[model samples]
Target: MTPSLTEDGTLPAPAGNVIVVEESDMVDLFGVWDLVMVVSGVAWHLFTVVIFGWIVLRRHHFPPFRTRNLRLLGFMLACGILFWVCQVLTSLTTGRPNLPRAVCVLISPWLAYGLGLDLYMTILAYRLYLLYWLLVLRYPLRQSRRFYLFPILLGVPTALVLVSATASPRLVSTTHYPNPGNCVYSLMYSALCVVDVMIHIIVLLCLNYLCRHIEATYNDYRETTFGSIAFILLTIVAVNVFIWIGIGPPLYGYLFDREEYLAQFCVKLAADGLSCQGCHRRVDGSSSARLSYPPANPLHQHQYQRPTLPPGTGSYGETRPNDDNNSGQEDGRGTPGCSDSRTNGCRGGDDSLVEMAPTSRGITQQPADKNGHIEEWSLAHVAYHDDESNQLADKDYTGTSSAPHPPQHDRVIIE
Candidate 1:
């Protein structure tokens, strides 16, 4: 009778057309595959990290990676780095004695549970937060008290997935082949995906509604950024399904079942980078960030004496008088620029290379109001600097800058 097992300790292949491969040779196939899987995954994580860090250091980021956002990003990157560090340790213990593998197994789950899921959950949570801002709150992303909801959004789903996955027998088991150590698929991605799908559905519905809402409320807002955000999020969930379907839990049943942590982290890192790029891109192109909006009620248009602008100042640069309104409310908000201290002087994200408008002034924000209400009802569109000559408008025309402000015939906005 043919032996049930091969010499090097793996199940024997089928006898007939299988061509009777040697036990050692066939068993080595799994070890080699694992080596390749990990090397590729680790290398991918490192490449993305280096590339991502370079972008962070060299280029100005939008939303300017500061305040709470900055802290979250810093922690996110740390998670990725530490993930691989733990992975390397766990992997080295493979094929070693029980104590080393046991020690690695004990620590690796918690490390992954704590750090590995953060970026993934944050992506979902931020998406939810964005939907809330656009739909329910109607607040600017940069200015939302709803930031408090973020912890709940992030923590609840992550903890449930971890808890559920660990409870399931499928969480961690023997690696394929004769590998003795219990290596887990990435946080058992299958469990996390249930929450992912639910959130994705809700986000898609909100975005669809937002496209219509933007048309009605804001002047000249585009849905391109919103569309891009939807696509990025959809891609995240879809890729999870693809990866999980392919190399499932660490088990021998599948032809090439393997570890999932490294693979999952690499995908998550790349997705986060794309999402960040999408956020920064919102400020560019024909975006109307610089222009102020008309009053919500046409009947209540506020007006003041038209401030003098130098003759050559771009035609579009001058503010329009409100329709059918008496002049002289005694402008509380002075003309915006360096000339007026009372005005909201040119201010915005300090890290602003990526946010330059056509004037190249970079991204800018209106000064916060004293009553704590943001008067910038216009999206407070990006604040812009008038041409050098225009800043001297209050001065004599003859004293205008020698270079002369050119007429902005090319620049036009439809009221």
Candidate 2:
């Protein structure tokens, strides 16, 4: 850090690994950089809160991946506030003076620095799970959100909190600085650096995975969204490389603590930003733009756009009420059912139509003008549509079926 203080007749330069100068002198030694870091952390938190609030107020869920999303982000923000509360309480009690080394160590916010950071990582982890499900499962959340995905999302961080609470006292410690009147905590002192690096590495891996998947799946994905994420990913990687600097021991190892905050801010920024990119956001970077989709509409709603007339079967692709050979019948609305066996458009009992799937963040819809019905789609619908729609049994007037029906019969009222 600061140039040798001994040269300026100040307290002799910090000697050895630990501060040899009296603890009281350490306060003035902290200097200005500490204030910059504190301010940066506070500012980022406020900015994230503002963004979170805007999303909540608008009832915008771009990806529509999960319900109560705004509620979930709100709860996370509230949990983060508790840490600031702890810091305030700690400051009020001791005022961070020439307290014994042991006293400050005991009072430094444990949950805030230790478990809290891990909790934030969970947000990034969700993105990873989103991609994994898409690549392998074909349909997101098809395996059972209640028994599997939901529990993992909620329980993993919860489990970490429990373990951290039990183990923190033994694994975490703090260094008190009088000048700034604060206690800087480290998880197990310097050793926690390794743990911190491990966490970031995992985050980096997740980002890398996300980028690769994005390239493969959303090759023509809106460039604005993809570019923003790519910038974030590159920025993080570059910063990490600069800090580590080479294949051996870091040439700039000392700067890690300084750069870590920036790196972390970027990571969380990417996560929060992704929450909005799933829907609405367009190539022009406008959320208010009219909804448009790529050729592969994820919900497979395009098939219902126009009822194609069967070859020489009939006009309007509809079997009249007096068709003597008619096997399929019509509903009161004159909508065709699978009763007509002459045409390939007719269904038997159960045939695949289109299945609604969750998006990355928000829900979208397209209106079938001729069909007089609106079809809903999610942001990540492109990743969802399949040749074989989820087979649904048809037993009632509103019942769904797997029967191969012509575009005319593909229409159904979504309830």
Candidate 3:
């Protein structure tokens, strides 16, 4: 039997309020669906923490912490931890009625607001980083971490929590279960969600503009393997759009249906997953390093042309003998003082000069000059031989000799 209103017109306190409900009643009110969603949200947050923890452990010794991507990742990881803590507290305080009203009222709003701010800052930071990279072609390294971190991490969230705590009727009430309905805090939460959606829309538009600019400036921009910043932004926008439409006003749904809050958690997980993957890909140099382009210098464009030989000539520009007509041509074993077209010098059968071919191995044998002097070859063209081998003995042919000397020794000639 509930108490009736007094003659003074004061009504009886509501039984459904969190402050009056017993632990047993609270447990029963939490249906199976609620428990499932809560558990899943908690598990997802734990998974996020583990993933980022592993990343930190692996990269702790490296200089990656200074990079924009890692800084963003660090912020996400911190936010995930805070969010996980909040979820765990919600599960405990909402389920166990033994918690003091003062403690719940004090901590709950701070945890919730801090979580929201963390997510907001992560998206904001990543968007700004992308803009800097695209427009300036450099990182925002000069900006101190405190420049962004303090405002997002501590200052804004603290102020919001304080404002909500002071102005919200439910949050300041002494009830065991203060309902977060029709309060300043709820309005603030709704405004935050709206702001999130708006920011995402702005980011999407900016990304489109940047993509168009890249295409207009670089003829082969599409062929480049730039990391998927546009794709990541699109994904984030889609997630926010789905939340805005499907969930229908986040704060209202979150206050009435706890499942909507779970959906928010899921959205956070999705955004973090996309960001981590995109940032990791960019940092690893896998995506950005694959852009191919033509050489800058024209000389380098023809660095590897095929070796062209003179007409009616064999390898090394040596004249090929006509088989049918042996006019004044010596036998295969030409004697000393014989003019052999193949040798381009006087030759004898012993240690005969053999014309060498230019191999595909970048080895070339220059033709003798009109003064009957052998042209110099680079060391790359010279082949080496062992001293023990007597196949072709070394002979100094500096001056004219009637007897054809063997091809210059295998000793490498620099020029």
Please give each candidate's TM-score.
Answer: 0.32, 0.33, 0.34
TM-score-better candidate, 1 vs 2: 2
1-415 per-residue lDDT for model 1 (tens digits): 7567778988766544323323353222237756786789788878877876775676536543331244445566677667666766666654432332234334455465445545544553454455556556776766656676655654666566556545554654444312333355455554565555466455545544544454333311244357558879999988797787675653342234222322222223322332212222112343222222222343433321233445544222333223122122222232212222322221222211112222221212223245533332111122232332232111111111111111111111111
Question: Which 10-residue window in model 1 sums to the lowest lDDT?
Answer: 398-407
Candidate scoring better on TM-score of 1 and 3: 3
lDDT per residue, candidate 3, 1-415, as tens digits? 7778978888766655234543356453467866787779778877877876776778655654434356565676666567666655565555444554455544555554445444645454455545446454544546656345533543443466556665665544433335431112245555654555455445545544454444333311342224346757888997798677766765665577544333333323332322112211112344211111122333332222234434443222332122223323443433222345633443322223221112222222233346644333221222222222334322211112122222332111111
Model 2: per-residue Cα lDDT over 64-147, one tens digit each: 523325555565576566566555445454434444434544444245544354454454344445554555445656666643
Error of 2 at 26 (Å): 9.6
**Model 1 segments more than 4 A misplaced:** 1-44, 61-114, 127-136, 139-147, 164-415
For all candidates, what are the clash counts?
1, 20, 4
RMSD of each: 30.4, 30.9, 31.3
Candidate 3 ranges beyond 4 A from true positions:
1-27, 59-68, 84-108, 115-161, 167-415
Predicted structure 1: lDDT: 0.41
